[model samples]
Target: MPSGSVALSARPEIIGGPPPGAATLEARDACAWFGDRLVLEGVDLVMPKGKVTALIGPSGCGKSTFLRLLNRMHELIPGAALDGEILLDGNDIYAVGTRAQQVRMRIGMVFQKPNPFPAMSIRENVLAGLKLARLKCDDKDTLVEQSLLRAGLWKEVRDRLDSPGGALSGGQQQRLCIARSLAVYPNVLLMDEPCSALDPTSTRRVEETIDELRGEVTVVIVTHNMQQAHRVSDLCAFFLAEENQPGFVVEQGDTLEMFSSPRDPRTLDYVEGRFG
Candidate 1:
């Protein structure tokens, strides 16, 4: 881990449970910097267990930066530094002696682009997280099936588990990536524009996967699409960064209320498509 890097850990039993449940995530007065420049500041938010929380903003608003901070990915960059605490289920993830790998296993990430190992078979890809985390699976077949079923991709690819993950369609590949994340039984999942690069159908399928993930995995997504945010998230936080200033939350509330009746004018402007 880097000088200022934070890590997390949990009880071993939480690693691969028969019924893995979500965890509440809270950021308190969180701030991030790259070397001498601050990129995000004073971020305070709570994402309840078993629900979706969407971070909405235009590019460069620190929504993605904030998402990375949740799983300790922000600390990977050289000279990166952060202040404040991130708590998972009431325990600070940055507590001394915690391990980065353990934090990642508990809080997985899905990126904008679907990235599956081109040469690895679908089944292998699903099981890859266990290998990386050095976790044991009593029955690999059952784990694979359950993970794929939770990700909503099992029925489509059950007959071809041996096929390369890269051979699946764009939507299927994204769902495969979701299954890969789920295979580790992460309590929280962070998505950075998971549907941006896909076509409408693929995007819709990905959204459905996210919906199905509720009650099993906590989700925090960074999205520029207001409609998509409205369609998927239960909670919404609008972020904004004025010129030469660090990004901060402009407004945040229940998804319906935030969209229909934002207390902040900036939020209304952005959501109404009048301005970013």
Candidate 2:
């Protein structure tokens, strides 16, 4: 097994049929670049199964880049390249014969912005992933309801299933995106500042959804919001890059410990509003 990779164990039952089973994601000696410029280097971290891990750092520290690497999204950028292994359940996702599409299916992503197909109805938006992945569901109605319920948006939009997804409020749209991701039943969910674009109420709702999904999906979120990170995450990793240097992990541990008793001065400074 790669360093930081944990053995899989039996998963508890979840709402959407037999659990897809949460997975431990491990990055080993991970380095990323855009063309010839090294942006992130030597990052090794373990995202434990069925827990929320927050990547908290200042802007331009490569937190988003690192999150993209886990699901093979990094390769989508022109001139983007990465070194080292990203392990899912101890298997290398970047290994030969491993298809990018398959990796993405197992590891779904929710972006910084809510991106629902504006023309698609709410029901269609939720089932979009299944259609794109060629996954068949015996009962689409039940799946939609279950997904929306899990995302904490079912009651609000239950009667408006036929409404255009874009017609919903910003927070509702974001939760709809979460429902879409959940419909595919991914083992690991990657969120990039999921609540950054929402109002406070919407942010709270999204955070509530994140808390509810804990222990059912392994979640890795990148956030500049320290308070949100502390509230929603079980583990935290702090990344830092000095002047003209490649970004790297400065500290990582339990969320409470990282906030209350961080060993590194940089972490303390960043967390206490001293500096990024």
lDDT of 1 by residue, 1-276 (tens): 222111222222324432467999999999999999999999999999989999998899899999999999999999999999999999888899978888888899999899998799999999999888888876788778777877778989999999999999988998899989988888999999999989998898788888877766899999989999999999999999999999999998999999999999999999999977
C-alpha lDDT of candidate 1 relative to the true structure: 0.88
After superposition, candidate 2 runs with Cα above 4 Å error? 1-19
Which prediction has the highest lDDT against the true structure? 2
Error of 2 at 42 (Å): 0.2
Clashing pairs in 1: none
Give the per-residue lDDT digits (tens) of candidate 2, residues 1-276.
222112223222233332486899999999999999999999999999999999999999999999999999999999999999999999999999988988988899999999999999999999998888777777788778878888889999999999999999999999999999988788899999999999999999999888888877899999999999999999999999889999999999999999999999999999999997
Give the 10-residue window scoring lowest on summed lDDT in candidate 1: 2-11
Cα error of candidate 2 at position 225, Å: 0.9
